[model samples]
Target: MGKLVFLSGAGLSAPSGLSTFRDNDGLWEQYDLDIVCNYQTWIKNFNLVHEFYNKRRLELRKVTPNKMHEKIAEISKRFEVINFTQNVDDLLERAGCENVIHLHGKLLELHCTNCNDITKLNLNDDLEFKFENCKKCQSKLIKPSVVFFGEQAPFYTDLYSTFYNLNEDDLVVIIGTSGAVININYLLRFAKSKNILINLEKNKYINEALFSHIIYKSCDECIDELEQIIQEWNS
Candidate 1:
């Protein structure tokens, strides 16, 4: 099978109208990253944490999948595509792509922190902020199962193993995410050690040695080029 794995970041969704996790000002707008996203913050201020996520969930409803998303979905038809995205939006799935792995967590699914029971939520403009209670235990429900800062990333071992075991000829695409966080820098190194082709957007601080080709463009533009490259390779 043609192996092509894509690791997408916030940049991939920007064209779709979703705001990046960090704005140009280096904050998620009004909220400090540590005070609202860390484990201590969640334990100290559950209500505030819930409110922050609820706001993000509401925003997710307003965005639509961009051309880049569509192109990725279309490319998957001819290749064994594995999309591991940091984005919580459902755009990739909406674009008809399968085998998507969400590293951060999805915005549409809610989970009871007490019971760990996950359920899909329907979002609308009229959506009210009602704290859902777990049916089994009657405990307060939290937002979807996601890995916040200071929390160990869920399924780290599984993801590592999956990528490590892939054939040497497999292609790995990294988009929009920074060189750090979610252990992406480590994964990039691993891919490089094996001489796998790594593609990513040109970021100044990112170690240039890790990537085979650095596309100096946004994710939307990169996807357009990627689609063309894949088509030519297949032909």
Candidate 2:
């Protein structure tokens, strides 16, 4: 059976009241990437970085999945689907979408540098507001399970493997990403399948020519159309 591969970014989660990084009033404007998101400065500015992601984790807990997320979850039940997301948020998983491949990583998880063990953060409890010692290794060197600006993304190999194996009969749908970090133009070169892009506006970083279809609209606004396409393809 042909698979539907959803390559999503911050725009996919924008409707859930999350801030995107590339927009005019995005999070990048509020926080300095050099201090909070750079790997080189992370160790020195550990407190600042931990505080930054802690706040985001709390924010993530408060917001619920929007229509697009729910729609993707519903579609997955009847069709072969795989999600490769640049966004670290768990909105997709919370919406019941399975087979999600987080290229950047997850927000509600911590990685211990000492033991390399990943621990799921408990948002139900009062957040400590500090990077607590890893339970497995008792080391204070725990960072959010996210790829920093200069850090290598270990999950990219999974994404590459998935893309490398895609056949011409498959479908690639990209949503709400500017392609500044993950090169959408380059990655799609491996997909010899139908490519679709859904976004509110044109992205200069993306090579529009590569896409077979493009929709300039909010993800929620295009859900009905997207669902119809997916349903038809699955049938």
Candidate 3:
């Protein structure tokens, strides 16, 4: 079986009207990242964090999967594809992609801060929300079931090992992520070690040498090309 892995970042979801964290013109109504995304801020003011993520969830509810998402799903049918996304959005799953690993977390899942108990919840189109309490112990819920800033990323060791041990012929595709994020950079290196790095970027970053093929284009265009490439490869 041909192995194809995709590592996607925020840009993958931009076509669906999701704003990236790097948007400079205050696309998110001037929401401060540190206030809602950092661990210290979450600890100091859980309500603020909750409200922010809740708003994001509401936005997610309204947005549907875009063309790139559908193309990835179609590509998966021809190859043994694994998607590892830094985005919390569930757009990939909505597009019918299987075996997705959310490196950051999922918007539809919530965990208890005190108990680490995770539960999937149905999201509504509302700016404010609350989730059901933990079954074992009643506690407040948090979004993404993921580690925030200043916290160690969960399943890191396993994620690292999996990336490193892929077969030599495995094709690793990096899409939209910046080269600066340590975890993603490490994974890029791992793909390089296996001699397979196919990266797609709209703009150049520092670690340009890691990719075997670098396509500078929007995710929509890159994914369209990827689908054609996969079809040819499978044939």
Candidate 4:
């Protein structure tokens, strides 16, 4: 009867063949984040940004959920699980997890700049960058739904609310986040609960002191240990 809040990032989906922005040959290397993923210059490089995300959408369709994602989905069936992910991919949904909240928005969706109506992109065919009209308002200012660096995340309010409402006995599990975009320490300040951190590498940005338990391993590598810890906590 306990709540488990999973604060997952790109690492959660990395095992499924998706690349993180920080990866050596990752998207960030191929394209400058300031030019491609920054909201301030989004309009200036509209076609470039669209092309980048369009390729990502196509790549997402080719990969399947890994063991870690499937395990998390299985755990959700037995516990009160809430997912807050910074990733734009739908791998968690594809792995059968329900009601996963995307903190950074999603890739397979386009929002009208003028009307702000979100439309699901068709991945059945090859995606290309084009100024598509909005389905609802018929405005021609559509862009990828993912939140850029300079834009405000619409779901941050929900994230703060979720943390503030938590009980001290609840568990907060942070996975694969480097605290680059979202400050881990600041977010955890609202949660009066035990915390866990799982990451593949050490990040200077993250304060290791915050977590009661820390695992420096990939999500897939530590799934068994992670499940055991969660089970013990629930018990």
The TM-score of predicted model 1 comes to 0.85
**lDDT digits (tens) for residues 59-162 of candidate 2:** 87678899989988997887788888998888998899987888888888888988999877666776444656888879998988888888999888877887
**Candidate 3, 1-235: lDDT as tens digits:** 4577777887788778887677754435666777777876676767777777776777777788988889888878766777778888889988999878887777777777778777675654333445556676776544456557876777566567768877756767777676556455566565533222334444445366665566766677666566555555456
TM-score, every prediction: 0.85, 0.92, 0.84, 0.92
Better of 3 and 4 by TM-score: 4
Could you give the C-alpha RMSD of every candidate to the true structure, in order shown? 3.0, 1.9, 3.0, 1.8
List the candidates ranked by TM-score, beginning with the highest: 4, 2, 1, 3
Residue pairs in collision within model 3: none
- Candidate 1 has an lDDT of 0.69
Q: For residues 1-235, could you state the per-residue lDDT of candidate 4 as single tens digits?
A: 6699998998988888888777756565788778878899888898888878877888877888888889889988888989999999888888999999999998988888897877776666655546667778887678898898889999999988888888878988999888888888888776678899999889898888878899999888998888888877887
Residue range with the least summed lDDT across 10 consecutive positions in model 3:
192-201
Q: Which window of 10 residues has the lowest lDDT sum in candidate 4?
A: 121-130
Q: Which stretches of candidate 2 lie over 4 Å from their true place?
A: 24-30
> At residue 114, what lDDT does model 1 achieve?
84
For residues 1-235, write the lDDT of model 1, one tens digit per residue.
3478778878788878787655543236667667667875675777777677677777777788888789879878878877788888889988888878888777777678787877776665443346757877888746445677877768566678767776656777777777556556567666632222223345554676766556767667666567656655455
Give the whole-model CA lDDT for all candidates, comma-separated. Answer: 0.69, 0.83, 0.69, 0.85
Best by lDDT: 4
